[model samples]
Each structure stands twice: as structure tokens, then as C-alpha cells.
Target: MSLRRLLAPLCAGTLLLTTACSEGGEVAPAPRADPPAASDPGEGAAEILADMSLEEKVGQLFVPTLTGTTPEESAEVISAYHPGGFIYFPDNLQDTEQIVALSNGLQDRAVDDSGVPMFLGIDQEQGMVSRLPVGERFPDAMAVGATRDPDAATSLASVTAAELSALGINLDYAPVADVNINADNPVIGIRSFGSDPALVSELMTAEADAFEAGGVVPVAKHFPGHGDTDVDSHTGLPVIDKTRAEWEEVDLPPFVAAVESDIDMIMIAHVFMPELDDSGEPATLSPGIVTGILREELGYDGVVSTDALNMEGVRQTHDDGEIAVMAVLAGADQLLMPPDLATAHAAVVSAVEEGRITEERLDESVLRVLRLKLRRGLFDAAPVDPGEAAEVVGSAEHKDAAQQVADSSVTLLRNEGGVLPLREGASVRVVGSGSEEIGAELEGMGFTLAASAADADVAVVGTNGARGDAEQKGLVTQAQDAGVPVVVVAQGNPYDISELPGLDGYLATYSSVDVSRAAAARVIAGEVNPSGRLPVDIPGTDLAFGDGLTY
Candidate 1:
């Protein structure tokens, strides 16, 4: 059968299925058709899942983090762990050539060993959490949220999906569904798509749809929400004080939307919620939250993944080897970046053998893993052309899309006395982490950088780092002292503006990445109209969510 013919029935069935699930609870099983043909990839996936041996099936549930870059270097670890997937970091990626070759070799080795393709996952969240050293970068999640434009969200994901897929990465741990309601949230501040539940849901769901259209599986992270907490899960477990009603009203909506939209994976956070689970265990190890609520109440039947298992949040409580078993028993399908690979894998295997973990439960997760890999086209095509990776990363089209998002995401919180949109040939003084990029961009836009702050028509100072609030305060104080009509450009957190008392202008890019910095400069130089509204509010200011100035 032709491809369209094969997809036609499945597509209708899928829509009907999701609609039914959304309207009510789970739908009844449909009538079975005749045995599927070999050409149907869905059936092929089922066949492969059924034929897998115990070892291969078990391996499909583990996705260990590899320390090596080369296939030869990683061979022993892959051979030993036989993970269904691997997550790569900056250490794993040297260049386009090296990483693509590494993926090709690993996939080739996996098929050779177990006749299964490995899923290569990357945390390409783009702004704060970028894995690859060089790719078309976007402004952070909050910045995209500032745009409040679903098109911008989709555009960024489309570029990201193309770049990652070309690099042989099948899964992207992105489109953070976490709404950053708490400004003091140490880890998930700008990483989330702003604080509003409805807005965050809209952007994140749009991002997931874009990723699916752009050829990658989008994993919505920190499920049941990580927005309201003030602690970092990587260090210590943050406890949420909200009741179940509050969770449903605030944090749970995005995850609910994602699952209802057929999102591929929902990542569990390591934060402890006393209301959800009184056991003191993080969601990663709590069957009450993961199985009872997320699986049963929430109606999310897709793969449930845990955040990095090596993080101190879950690591401090569970034995290194035992975390995997607990997470699986808690209803997690994939264990990500376990601290002790050999021990974790062995313990999970031992649990299965000892009837501590049921084989039926194990296979359910493994089969979902296999079906996801098949949907990613991994079974049909595992190895990507090396030349394709070289040609695609940060390509001109992607760069254009990145620039469009950044420009659209430029939110101006304060432009007291019309201090912005400086004259075309105005002299502007730029300073901060990305001063070079901002300076060059301003110069390119017919503005000249002044030799001194006193010489400039307007002093544009860029300040970042949430922890360096004091340093930014001093800069703002000094610039405010110079009295050169100081225009503060917030590169990372919009909250930085609050550190500066009185200012002539305040602009936020939400990041210091190249495209974002350029967008800030463009907005300052009057090259682009600043249309982005505040995704987050600057504390101690009149600015609130949905506040932005247009000139």
C-alpha cells in the first residue's frame, strides 16, 4: 500500500481516539482488523516488540548517559548496559562530524547486537540549557513567552527540530511545560514559558505540535508541574505546598494539555509535593504521584520519563542501584542518566527476575519505547548522512527563523519619558556579557558605539545572571549616576530590571545568546518595533504580566 493509504486510516483512528479520551475517560477497545501487512510500520513495531528477548526488552527501558564520544570508546559501556537510548551533553558533542559519526556507530552497533535502534536524546532547550556547542539558538523560554505568539513558538521549534534531527538526535527534551509562577524559582525561572497556566499551555502545546511536524519527539518536562517551587531539583528536593485543587488549577493544566495532545513523553520532576505524596519521596520515586495520579487520574498513557536520576534531589534518598527499580515501579518508562549505570541496570534486572517488578509492567514500558522509536523513523533509518549534519546546523534559514523569534520576543518593560527608539545615527554605549554582539548589531543598524558613557546619546547597559543582582545593581547605580539617560537591557531575567531603581528605559531579551542580543539591539536602535510583552513581572515595579510598550 502507498504511504498515504496506510496513514489515512490510522490518522482518523488516532483523532477519534484522542477526542474520545478528551471527552470522557478511556475509550473501549476497538474491533480488531485482519492481520496487518509487512508494509505497515505500526504493525512492524508491534511485531518487533513481541519478538524481543528478555535481555533486549530490558535494555529497551534503560537510557544511560555515556561518558565517551567515539563508538569505540563507548562500545564497552553500550555493550554492557545495552541501553535503549543515550542522552548526549556538551561533553559528548565535539563537532558536527564527530557527533554524527558517534550516533551512526552507536546505532549500527545496537542493531548488530540486538536488532534494535537506539534513541539518541538531547536537552536542546536552546537558551539556558543548550547541549550542542553550535546550533541555531533561540531566546529562552520566558523570552518566547514574552512574544505571546504561538507562531514564534512553533517557528523556534521547527528550526530546533531540523537541526537536532540532522545531528542524528531523535528525541528533544524540550518545550518545558512548567509555568514559572514563582519568580524566586532558582532553576526553572526563565526556563518555563512564563507564569500563566493558560499562556504556558498554549505555547508549550504549540511547541510540541511544531516538533512533531518538524520530525522529532517533544518530551514535556517536570510533569505535575515544577513552576511554583523555590528550590532546584538538581541540588535538593523542592517541596510544593499547593493542595490538589491548586495543582490542577495551576501546574497540572499544561501536562494535561500535552498528554491530551498526544505528546510523546512526560518527564517526572524530582520535587517533593506533600499534598501529592506524603511519603517524602520526589515524584520520580513516588507511585502515588506517578502511577496513581499521572497515570490513572491524568489519563496519560504515553511514556513517563524521569528527570536526570543522578541529580541530588532523588540521589540523596535512594541507593544508587535502587533508584531505577523504584522509578520503574513508580510507573516511569525511561530512566534518564542514572548515576551508577551497571548497578542500576543490574538491580532492575534482578527485580524482574525476583518478581519484585512484574514482567507485564516491564513490557508495557518497553513496547511504548519501541513504538516511539518506530514513530521516529529509527527502524526505517537509523544512520544520518554525515554531510547532512554539516550542511544543516545553523543554516541561513534557521538563523532567519531564530532572528524572527528573538526580534518578536523583545519586551520593553519601562520606557520612561520615551527614552527608546533612539535616532538612526545616534551614538549608543553598549556594555555587558554580549556587549560585542550588541555593539556590532547597533553599529550595523546605523548607530555608533560611544568612546565613553558621557559621549553617548544614550547608555545601553546589558546585565545578566540572576545571582549577580548586586553586580547589576552597581552597574545600574553607576550608569544612573552618569546620568546619560541609562537604558537597561535585561539579557537573562526580566527581574534584573528591579535591581535598578530609576531608569530612563528598560528592555528584556531574556537571554544573552547571539540572536537574542541582536534583537535587543535592534529594538533599541529603532530597527525593529518592540512588540513583546512581559512573560514575567519585574518585582517592585508597575510592570506585570501582559505589560509591554510599543513605539
Candidate 2:
């Protein structure tokens, strides 16, 4: 089927203004549960615990990655491992129908065999880490931060949660609470709110509360903090050398806010902290950080999830089975994206049977898992209907809300030096990687694209700042040298503009999502006012944090 044909149902409308809803209605935020007590499973919790076998209980701790878009396609693994739920990757997604059907089938099979549902999850944080893609496009966290409106993040989480709920996705590993303290931090730049602890904490809480209010479980991530590291953890573990006092001041606030706001889970990053644990274990495998600090000291009785176990950060040092055991021992409630499902499941099973992991310890995780599922309303609800999913997934309202957020997030870093809100019919020459898409979009909006920089009145270039690649910078440099006023659109992080300081105008959209892209075009073309303030500092420029210009 054509993409529009498939996307229409899932990505048709934005959200409606309704009461007591996940979509943006004026509802009292959901009640935050105090840290979970070990015995405090809801009514009939004991009976539910009694009915579960050791293997089944172990399955609930694992949110394994599935390789297919259908339950039948993934049946063998699902049947063998009996994961607590599944975390979908791009590999498992096809189109809208396939994913909706996949979720329904998975839920049906789980209930038929185990009498309990599973937590279907995705890292739909928007921007760089989005999984299970389709429907309304949202600006990433940094873009939301640029707006400096917690409500924008709330709206983002609201529509996102509504879409996931429509697709039977109960959990979102989202609202990345990491404060982007290090400019060179590879993974968490645009994913974080901003550099400030207070801003990150405030926006993180607002977004988490919105997700919960929208009937989706929001997970705050990279506990302790992954924002200060210069290395990418997906390849190797980077050590954080911050003192305990420094961490408490800078890195701990967002997580504290998340826990206090009753975030459903906190995804643990795999970075090593020399101060917290001298044994050299990454936080994912460290009981000191996970149990001693997060569980006991912080008193966050919510679920604790590991970042994808398959990532080389934690995978290189130990085998999958060992990682699974260690994660449990560390007091993590859910195991996310375990690489070898069979090995991890089997290891956990053996750990329990051999008394390496006590039954009571296992139940705490299981009870918390099931309790989270209950909060997500998975038990009373039917599997997401494939037919109705389209209505909610890409509703017009969601698209509009996303565009509004994107528009508000468009930060003008250096626009006063030149002119913006370029006239609609101006001869604009757009040249850069992915410029054709923007050119086509602008062309459709009645802006004429000049054949070359020499022929155009002005030149606009689109590129990612986080990439810091020469080719993207080279294209803009050529335009600047050609005597054309160059307007560089920083599509990822705004830091890349540091490489090309002579530009007449610079805009940071914080992402390349459709809404962000469209917002950039509108703001540049004078159609929409640029309201987004800077969420992060531009390393080599005078634009400080929280700077923006509007026409």
C-alpha cells in the first residue's frame, strides 16, 4: 500500500480537547503513586503471584526485542522466552497496519497463554531515537526545550501517548531527562531538554506527568547521568569522573523530579561512574548505583530499566546471561532490549530456581511490572483494533499540535545580522544534503528555487549541527563565497554553525522531523513567527542559552 494510504489512518488527525484524556484536555494530572512497597501489589496481587510460575515470572522482567511485525512471525521467540513485553525496533516495523496488527496479535497470544498482558514499548522520544515511526512528527526534546514552555513538552507527550495507546504501545522510553552538560556528549544532546538542571527537571516533570495523564507510561532515562560523557556508549563505556557533590547538583535533579512525579520507569545508562562504584562496573550492572542509590537512597519504588542490553556499552564486558543476572541483582525491575532473548531468559530462570535470585525479589519486579500494566489500563482494554488505529495515530489535531510545537521551537541564532521571513515568492536557492526535500516543500509553497546560487537572490542550506560534517559546511561555505546571503538551517544541534561563522543567518530547528522541517520553512519564509529560544549553547558563538529572535 502507498505510504499516504497507510499513514492516513494512523496519522490522520491531532488530538481533541477532551476532559480526563491523554489527548490535550484540561484534566487534573494523574495521581502520582508513592514509591512502591514490596508487598503492595494491588488487590488480588497475592493470588496473581501465586498463579505465576518461576519462568513466567522471569519473563515479566524482560522486555525483549522482537524481530518481526506479527506475533506469528515472532511466535517462536515469544513462546520460548515469554518476555514481560517487547521493545520494537525499526526492523519490526512495516507500515501502520502491520504494527497495529502486531500489537493486537502479541496481546492476544499473551492473554491466551499466560492470562496477563504484556507491556509493548518503544523509544518514541522523537528525533534521533524514535522507534516505531509514523504519524504526526514531533520536534525532539531540545526543540521542545527551545520553546521554554513545559506545556509544549506536555503536549508532545500527550499526543505521543495517545498515539501509542491507540497502537497498544503502553510504554514509552521517552522524555529523556538527561541534562546536556557536555557539548561533545554524542548520544544525549538533542535528546536532553537543555544544559541547566532546573530547566531539565521542570520540563522532564511536565512531560512525564503529561504522558501519565495521557494514559501512557513515561520512562525517564540514563539515571545518575549520561550527559557529561564525551564517548558514545553504544560502542564503548565512558567513565564519568564527577564528584558525588557535583553529580547531586547537576545530574540528579531531573531523575529526582521524575521519581517524585511518579514516572513509570527510569532507564539506566551503561556509563561507568568512578565515584559511585570503584569496581569499574557500568551503572547497568552496578548494585551500588541501582539498588543502593536508586532503590534505597532515592526511594524510587518504580520500575528500573536498562538501556538496550545489546548495545556494546554493556555487552562487550559480559555475556547476555550474565548481564541479565547482574541487572536483576542490581534491582532493575525490567530488562529492556536484551540481545540474546533465549540466553537471558534461561539465565534468569536458572538464577531463580537455584535461589541465586529469591522468589520475593522476583515478585517485587513482577508485581511492579503488572502494576504498571494496570496503570496503563491494558487489562480492561481490548487489543488495539487495527481499523480504528488510524483515526488516533495521525489525527489532524496531532499533526497541528506537533507543528505548533515545532514552530515554537525554531530558534533564530543569528538572524538579526541578515533578514528572515523571506518573502514567499523570493528566488531561494537551497543547496545542501537533504535540501531537495526542503526545496520541493518550499517550491510547493510558491517559493521559486533558483537554478544556481548565482541566479538566486538568497541561498538556504539545511544540515545537522551534531554531525559537524565537512560536506554540509562546505555547501554553505560555497554559497557564502558566491556573494549570496547564506541562511544555514541547523537541523540537529545548533553547534555545527560554529564551523561556518560568516553566515548571514542561522536557524536551529533541533531536528529533521517533518514538523521541524516545515516549521523551519515557515519561519524562514515569514509564514510563521519563530518563537523557539535556544535550549543549548552554541559553542563558538555569542548566542547564549535561551536566546531567540522573532519578527
Candidate 3:
């Protein structure tokens, strides 16, 4: 079947004005309508948009950060700026009760001031990138990819969405769509699904669908792909040297699949692609990339949000206010995490008034955001119950589901001489960083702790980002030199295996979360059969994608 046929039904209720799919499996552009007057209450988002003042409309374009965990801490900004939403960070989240109170308090103030509920957004990607203080920690994207089960992706995201929604968080910046082809990528290593475009597309679409179905708006992120860069965008801007065709082959499939799946929002990356736009501007502020390619070519009319404006990647040449104006002119609907909310808000209002940004252009974005809020039932949402939230955030059922994903994703890369499935009562020495938790789990499974490599029958050494860690390599070598059978468990990036040449056994957990660690211990104890496959190829080695062994 063709891709269009498979995706047509998914685009039925898309909020874009021009990109909704027709009944005949073809995209039929809807005619743009003039802004409606605030005459009818039944007009939904249109009427709401018309009633908003210019300051209010500009305010709607930004999703800024709050000062503290309490709503009172942000009351000054809320009253003065009338922001459309607030994005939560680790400092802003405490416990379930505190989170519920904070979310409800913020929403109440927003509605009282602007007659619109705020979009409570968070970067709750689970696994390594989680922000919630209370919730089940599921495996990261690479681990989910290892299982080759799209259902696992859906279950993980669904559980995450339920927890976030219970705490009144409506927008989840998650289900990273980048296809990680570059093994040296620092920022997006395990966040990406895998190296294959088709695998990333399938898993990303499943996760996005599950998030929406579970009542949280999922923003498929770092678009045009952040998977091929070696530098972290938070520290500096990374340039992608790929031609447009090369980009289409590797970095474009998952995003294309996301748009077709009716993803409501996409976060633009901060990387600069000279081939896409040779203007020396990052994708966040590039009109050609954001407007020409993403909007015109890809036919994505949903909201386009900028990756946090406070990052150094987008702050190199422009001030916070100027960056805000440029992003709006570049066709972005939301400015996420601006460094100065007051400055960014005022600059946008000034631009619209000065004709640098037309009021119609501003309306287009405000209307899109409003339509999304209405479609997601944000305006009609009631305050989340603190008691219910406490019960639901970290429930036993959700944790079990997380453990299942971790169990299914523990990839056994090598089992030389069938060294795995260690015998019960074997004395093992566990060494290396993040191995303490693993050791505790191993001891619970009837394994005796050894004081040193020479005292142990086997050595299980943990390696995290081990490519450059000489200490980790020394630990493994120390064990091997003592003639102790070594089983190396990669707790972070699986590429660590390439650094250690000779090993009796190797296991890749692809994450260091508690659940994944426990799952690794279970695999070592022969309690669970290892079923995960390699999500990415290990450079300088014969270990390629889909490589794993079972006893």
C-alpha cells in the first residue's frame, strides 16, 4: 500500500486550515476565512480569537517558564504579560499534590485574567529525559526500538500521558522523531528510536497517537532532525552538512510520518542546515526552512513551536526580543522557554503594531493555538484532584508496564561460551559507575557479592558513556586479566561496546533508569529471556542493527 493511503484516515480532524485530507484520499486545501467577530458564543475558537486583544494575541504565541513552583511566584508575570502558557522544569515540579495545586492555581489565574486556560507543558519524555517527580520510568526510545514492537511504544507513551494529565499537564514535548544515524551524536543518543528511518517513523507515529488518545498533546520534536549532530544544541549550534536529498533520505521520514499522522505540534530544532537555508540562521529563525519547507512542502498546518529560546544555539547573534520577532515572522506558532518573557512579549506586540509582523500573521498563529486548546478540551477541563493524582502517578500497574518494556528491550549483544544466565549462588563482583543499583538488584536474585575480581567467580562491570572513560575500561581489563569471566553491561549508550574489544559476554540496556537496571539484573539471573535487538550499528565493529543473541 502507498504511504498516502495509509495516512489519509489519520488526517481527518487535523486543525490546519489548508492541509486537511479529503474523503478520496487526497489533500484538499480549505479556504482561509476572515477573522470572525465576537458575536456568537457557538463559533468556538474563532469567536475566542476575535475577542482577544493584540497584547493577548501576542501573549498567546509564547510558552514561557515560571519563576518558582507556586503560582504566586509567577503571579506578577501572569498579570502583566497574560502569557498563553507556562512550561515546567524540574525545579517547578515537586510531588503529586504540589504539582496538582500548581497546575490548578496557574489555570485559575489564566482564565480569570484572559478568559482562556493555559497550556501546562513539560518535557516528560520518560526514561532519561523525564521531569516528573512521581511516575513510572519507562525505557527510552532506543530501548523501545530494540523490541521492534510498536505496541510497546504506544503503551509507554499512554502510561506517561495518563500520569501527566492526572497532574493537569496538557502538553507533552515528547516522542522524539529524529532518526539517529550518527552514532557520535551527544544530545540525542538514546532519545531517538533507531538508525532506520522506517523504524523511527513507525514507532514515532504509534507514540504520538497514543499520547493524543491518552489526553495530552504530544509535540513531535527537534524537527528536520536533531539526530545527526555531534554537538549539543543547548551548548552551541551544530551545522548539518547534508544536501537536501541526503536529508530527505535520512532525517525527513519520521517528521513526514508525524505530519501525516496528524501530529498537533512540532518543535523546530536549533541546528543550521546550510543546504536548506544558506542564510546563516538556525532552523528556529529560518523562514525558508520553517515556512518554505515545513509548511509549504510538507503540508503541515499544525502549530510549529520553537525549541527553547534560552538555549545558546538560538541566542548567538540576537537578543531575546529580536529572536521572538524573528521566530514569529518565520512562521512559528509558539515561542517556548524565552529567556525574558516580558521582553519577548512586548517585542512581538511592537512588531505587529509596527507592521514588521502583520496582525493577520499574528492572528493565524493565535487562532491555531486556540483551535488546538479547544480541540484538546482545555477550556472545558476541570481542576485535577490531588488525591486522584497521588494514586495514579506511580501506580503498580504503570510501573509493571514500564518493567515489561525494559525486560523486552535488554539486548544481549554477545554471549561467548554462553556466559550469561549466570548460575544461582555465583559470587560476582560488580564494578563501575551506576552499578550500585544493579548490584543491589543482583543480590536480590540470589547472587553473592564479591569483594574483589580475584574473589569472584564472574565479573559484571557497568559502562556508561564508556567510549572515553579510561576508568571503565581499566575496570573491565582488570577483571579480564585476573581470568574472571567478564560480562559488560552498557548502562547508557550501547556504543560503549566498541571501546571494549574482548569480553566474555555483553548486554546493552540502552538506559540507566531504575527499571532498565532491574531488567538487566533479571536477564543476568536467567529470570527473563533477552529479546531486544540492536537499534543502531556499533561503529568499528561487526555488530550491526538487529543483532542480538538468546540462550
Model 3 residue runs over 4 Å out of place are 1-43
Q: What are the candidates' C-alpha RMSDs?
A: 8.6, 9.1, 9.3
What lDDT score belongs to each candidate, Candidate 1 first?
Answer: 0.82, 0.81, 0.88
The best-first sequence of candidates by lDDT reads 3, 1, 2
Go through the candidates in order and give the clash count of each.
Answer: 0, 20, 0
Per-residue CA lDDT of model 3 for 1-551, tens digit only, reads 21122223245554222134677767764422212233432366776665667888888898998788899998878778878899999999889999999999998777656666789999988778998888999978999999999999999999999999999999999989998988899899999999999999999999999999988999999988999999999999999999999999999999999889889899999999999999999999999999999999999989999999999999999999999999999999999999988899989999999999998899889888988887787865777899999889999999999999999999999888888899878998999866798889999988998999899988999988888889889989998998989999898879988889889999999888998989999999899999999999999999999999987
Give per-residue CA lDDT, model 2, range 1-551, as digits (tens).
21112222212342111112345443432221111224544643454556667777888888888876678977776666667788888888877788888988887676555656778888899877778667677888999889889889899999998888888788898889899978888888889989989999999999889989988888899997999999899999989998999999999999988878778899999999999988888999999999999988888998899998988889877899999999999989998888778889899889988999898899988888877776666665655667778888889999899989988899887775556877657899997745876787788788899988988888998988624587777888788788978898888877887778777888899888877888888888888888888877777678788888888
Off by over 4 Å in 2: 1-41, 423-425
Best by TM-score: 3
Query: What is the TM-score of candidate 2?
Result: 0.90
Question: Which stretch of 10 consecutive residues in model 1 shows the poorest summed lDDT?
Answer: 14-23
Candidate 1 yields a Cα-based lDDT of 0.82
